[model samples]
Target: MKPTFIILSFFFFGMVLHLHAQSKVDSLTYYYGVVNQPKSNIQLAKAYNFFTKQKEQSIKRKDIEKAVFHLRLLASIEKKMGLLSDSEISSVEALRLLDGMTNPEMIKENRIGIYNHLGIVYRSLDNFSKALEFYSKSLELVEDEASKATLLNNIGNLYLDKNEYSRALVYFEEAYEKSPRLDLKMKARVLDNLGLAQAKLTLPGALSNLLEALSLRKTIDYIPGVITSYGHLSDYYLDKGDRETAQDYAQKALEQAKQLNNPQYLESTLATLVLLNGTPEVVQYKKLRDSLEKASVRAKDNFEYYRYQFSEQQRLFEESEFKRQKLFLTLILVILVFVAIYVVGRVKHNKEKLLKVYETETRISKKVHDEVANDMYQIMAKLQANNETEEVLDHLEAVYRKTRDISKEHSEIDVEGNFSETLMELLKGFNNDEVRVIVQSISKVDWRHFSNLQKTTIYRVLQELMVNMRKHSRASYVVLKFEQKGKSMAIQYTDNGVGTAIYKKGGLQNTENRMKSIKGSITFESNNDAGFKASIRI
Candidate 1:
């Protein structure tokens, strides 16, 4: 009876914890959806607790994937709350789960999202090198033109932080022009950033862009954006020594900042107001500024302490899991010596052949992605900007030449000659001097048995995988193995690069769709430390 009661008590405690987690999650949803301009640390803290509790439950159930989801959420929340280092560690841990994954499309999505978030966090921390790396990695995964434009804007912001105003202005312009009409807020932000960059260079269009951004913010009733625009206007006027206009905008910003009750903005507003004043209100504003600064520092310190505790606990847990896995793998390896010897010999033979082919293909791929692609992009930009018909024609002619060059390159591949050789050559392009690649079982497959459609699907799928790996993974080594089982064929690729987070339905999804179209299937696995892997059976 005592044992039964103890078990029942344990069950009841689990139920209570589950209920508490659900309550917190509900509160998070309400705050996210129902509250306007919610920026309280309390709100963010509640979100952090919710995910942390969920992560604990997931770990208890041995659901590493679910734990990853919770960790990613926690990371995003910590970032929003200004806990930079904690956010970075949480994102890193979330990515680590992908090491042994089989279907990483979901993880890839999570990874790219967290990568972008980490870039923002690093930028806020003024760590430009890390920020640029994360942004570049995120850029590699971005498919939509709008997403690319957004990343370009962020990268421009990085340049702005470095005071490279001219370089910043170029990226901001490209982002603004590439953004669609529907994304007016994004375009307005881009315009605002561009205006600031232009102002640094003393350019003509600075005022025009700022005013346009202000008008758009007003149209959308974006209060925070309005505050930001007002601040910019105040700074611009102040720089020009127009004290009256500067004070007016600063007063407006102060009023809005007070209404919003944001300590950081209020402090900024007060500082700006103090800069343009000798009035009695200046003394009062200064006092408020001092108090807000003190309170903000305390709050930030407390939050950092909390974040450290949570992250340290998670780190200990992950370290323990890693040790266990390492021990288990070591034990297993001890029982497979003969099989490992044969595998190593085969891999060495394939590596030699792959290296010779890789060099030739790398040259061709570089010519396409670097030379032709860049030339076409520059020409396209020029065509869009030039108003004169003759100039437009010249740029259009350049675009045509690059397009022809690409067509000629593709035509060099003989689909009828040998599909296996062609496929191997395609894989070869993904390798470089920094990374070693080995492919096996190419000769074992009878290419003549497969239909043209099957061969095409296989080629395209592998091509996407290799291209994605090259773009995002700073991999040191890669292995591709093929296996034939009855009428079905399986191809696997393993790479030692940064692992993926949950993937969205992007390139991998497109690959999956293509595979499904041909009654085939595909899977992916990755982790931050172990790298990325993909498998396809057709």
Candidate 2:
């Protein structure tokens, strides 16, 4: 795996382990609570005795304190996993069990050192008032700086969620001021939250916070966080009226999400791409959307398994009315899953098919350019090189021109359906020593016609575009246009050369003839210092 991927996997694994630990704790809590309940007094009393009873006489000594320690650790894990329900109940039970222990065991407040986690659960559940209550209580009780920092973070989270940016900043700032190692989880959380709150208060999308967010997110490979920052950056640029920059950042978010294979990120990206539908940036958005669809299908399959499990659980409970309702809900979910899966797949396939067609055309065009008619052209060059009789020389010239004409006459269109690749190749060739070409506006075009002949004519016109620029214009950079103007197609080229009028010869006049054959007309604009420019209309 790449270093980046390994790091991401590590973070993801940490998160996954956190979840598993939380789930195990939830299961343990449920089992223990059932034992402790008022309805099962006999079992509750037995289990309580089993847990509380300690032995110093045996090798395999029973340790109730150790068991409760494990339970406390589990509750902290639940709080980190965003399992608000599990964290809340588990934390309460852990606190209750830790109470009444010998003072030497707790030794100040070590026995039930987990109120910060309770605060976290409340924060996630959107009970900020309760969350702050728990956090303050924990702060007063815990002497450990790390635990205090965790409480501060929990309080910060509550304020942040409530959109109280100034308050949130204060909490995080305080947490950072204390021990940075407050949690086994990454330390960047404080910096990240600090930056976000700062951005909200300062600007719609401030640079400093966003840059910090990007650096940290990239370091940890936090896919959600990275996408979020990129999204903010995109919006920032868009709001600043830098459309290209905004568009670039937005599209980059789409690309990064696609590579990560995160369907959730892609879903967010697609909404942006749809907004940029007709622009060059839309291409990136479309590409990611197509990939997201494939992933969403797999997600649906997983959801189906969950639905099945839920159904079994409902059936076992013998709650017929609830079961009926769950069954209906399950059926509806399955259909929506199928439809979503189908739509995503269909969009993906169409994009693939389009790309394939583009590739095939490119291959054919390359063959014609480098392989076909090559030997004949070489032979013509060799024949022209020889010193011979006038009649023989005339014969040679006639044969060469006739062969060229024949090749030109029977020319078929080379349409590499891929505009992106085609445009790249065209631009590469357009750059040479004799002609300096400035070719912008080369991407994400909606071609006027899909006909093979039309594509062929356009390719030749472009080839002629380069030829004209090289031989005549003495251009520094060639600005070529392949655009649709209303009902007609227009092409323009400008260059810096000595002012000159139309003296049609070699490739320039020949290109003019070719243009006429395609029913296209060429016009020239020139200046003494600015040199010459040409535009063609079809």
Best by lDDT: 1
**Superposed Cα RMSD, model 2:** 35.0
Candidate 2: residue 420 Cα off by (Å): 99
- Evaluated against the true structure, the overall lDDT of model 1 is 0.76
Error of 2 at 506 (Å): 99
| RMSD values, in order shown | 37.5, 35.0
Q: Any idea what lDDT model 2 has? A: 0.61
- List candidate 2 segments past 4 Å from native: 1-62, 76-83, 103-113, 144-146, 179-187, 203-206, 220-538
- Which digits, one per residue and each the tens of the lDDT, describe model 1 over residues 1-538? 9999999999999999999999877875764432334455566666677678878998898788888877877886766555666777787777666554566687677767767877887777666887899899999987778887888899999999898989999999888888574277888898998898888888999989998999998898777788889998887887788989999999999988777665667878888777678676776777787678556644453333235447778889899989999998888897577678887766565444444444455567566767776777777777667654886677677776666544433333445778888987877766789888899998798877776656766876787777677778888888999998767899988988887784847778877876765668999887777789898999
Tell me how far the alpha carbon of residue 66 in candidate 2 is from the true structure, in angstroms, after superposition.
3.2
**Residue 260, candidate 1: alpha-carbon lDDT:** 64
lDDT of 2 by residue, 1-538 (tens): 6999999999999999999999866765764553322223344334333333311211144344554555555454444333456555555555544544565646346532665665666555555676687678778877677777767777787887777879888997788777445532334555556666666676443476567667877876666567777877776666667878877888989987786554546777767756655656676767677568545533332222234447667767678777888999999999999999997787567545544544564665445544554655665567667744677666656665555433443344436667646655765765777656676564535564544444555566566656565666666776666667555667666666665666776656766765664457877677666677788777
For candidate 1, give the lDDT of residue 337.
Answer: 79
